[model samples]
Target: MKRNILAFMAVMLMLCMSAQTSQAQLKRFSIGPYVEAGFPTGDFSTTHNPGFGVGLGADVKLIAGLTAVGSVGFDYFKGKTIDNGNTKIASAKVIPVRLGLRYQLISILYVKVEGGTANFTGDYNNGTGALVAPGLGIRLLGLDVEGKYEAWFKDGTHGFFGLKAGYNF
Candidate 1:
């Protein structure tokens, strides 16, 4: 199982690295940084407050209108007050690494899906989980605006709806 996962990662990495051909009229690659605001949903909201994150991403044009994308990011969430407002859950932090594909649907519109892993650290515990995100975005000039639903699964599932903005170079 581990070997298979490694093999898949290797293939994705190769695809992301192979944009060396010079004949394409479009840009072959882009790199950017983004900031996000996240709102926890379902039971996750009961214990956690809204969060913010920052990420850096890279994209390699695989073909016309298609790109392979990868990113690493950090998110921080403070705990919510509980038990008659006398106690609070510990703040949590997450580091996420992801790889995925983006397909342009129109001149400035795109859709994307990403899967990877998120490592979680809290005041009292730590763990890792599988992460999946599906999103819609628009690119105007060098700026991008996106909205995504992100789910993280370990023993159970937690999710957030997020809005992000970025500038690609």
Candidate 2:
């Protein structure tokens, strides 16, 4: 029920942002710092729970309704206590470099998809894997709000529901 409500709210927000675009000239370029919280699912939950991410990103307008997006992000997931033993206080760290495009459906509302490799290490076996993300974005008053579902297909299938908010300049 919570996911459904969040989805509904996102749709309504896009509608509202689209309505406002008709009244003002929208910005074509933006750069900023972003932070994301991740909820683990599937096999990822076996070892790690919820986590946090930080990144820097940029958007450049290409053509009508199209923009190029790129980001470098870092995420940390703490290990879970298993068999009554604490795995190391050190958290697994993952760095991902992604590039993709955003399509503006209406005014300040857009749909985005990105894919790249995430490199992970620390307190666990080092590994690299592909990351795919599909998401929605709402830009209002120099602030950017995004919600995305991320998947890491690696040693095990890992998934996350992510929420990200940032200030864009």
Candidate 3:
């Protein structure tokens, strides 16, 4: 009886091991392309118009429902010259390298917080400043959509509202 039980248990274990799917392999890393829109607020709105950007990023799973993310992106903004509200638009470019943490709250919902440095180069330059944002992420139709409030610690500017959407692999 003991030999028969042992044989049955061994067979079951082997069957379970073979039944493992490709999901585990795919879940290890996810890379995608993203698009973002920015809505400036407070002094920011007064000094800069709305903006849009596009980039690509990747996320690596750290633990259960946790991921480490790194991304580089570019943004374009129309800076409304400090002297006066000018109709002539001076284009400002921002290139940001960001690293952050994302925690899954549920099957389709997640919360993410990130901080990094953005290089402000081009016509209207304000040097470089630290960037911080807290966001909510949702997975739908094979895409991840996020809404965030971005805070910029700089000389003269406030934060902005950001909308992001991306497809994951």
lDDT of each residue in 69-152, candidate 3, tens digit only = 766778887877565644654666877667799999999899999887776777665578788889998976469999999776
Candidate 1 local lDDT, 35-109, one digit each (tens):
999999997888899999998777877788998888778888788899899988887698877889999999999
The parts of candidate 2 lying over 4 Å away from their true place are 1-27, 84-90
Whose TM-score is greatest here?
A: 1
- Per-candidate TM equals 0.84, 0.77, 0.77
**Candidate 1 accuracy as TM-score:** 0.84
Clashes of each: 0, 0, 0
Q: How much is 150 displaced in model 1, in angstroms?
A: 0.5
Per-residue lDDT of 117 in model 2: 72
Cα-based lDDT for every prediction: 0.82, 0.76, 0.75
Q: Which ten residues in a row have the lowest lDDT in candidate 2?
A: 1-10
Cα error, candidate 3, residue 54 (Å): 0.6
Top candidate when judged by lDDT against the true structure? 1
Give me the overall lDDT of model 1: 0.82
**What's the CA error at residue 134 for candidate 2, in Å?**
0.5
Clashes of 1: 0
Q: Stretches of candidate 1 above 4 Å error?
A: 1-26
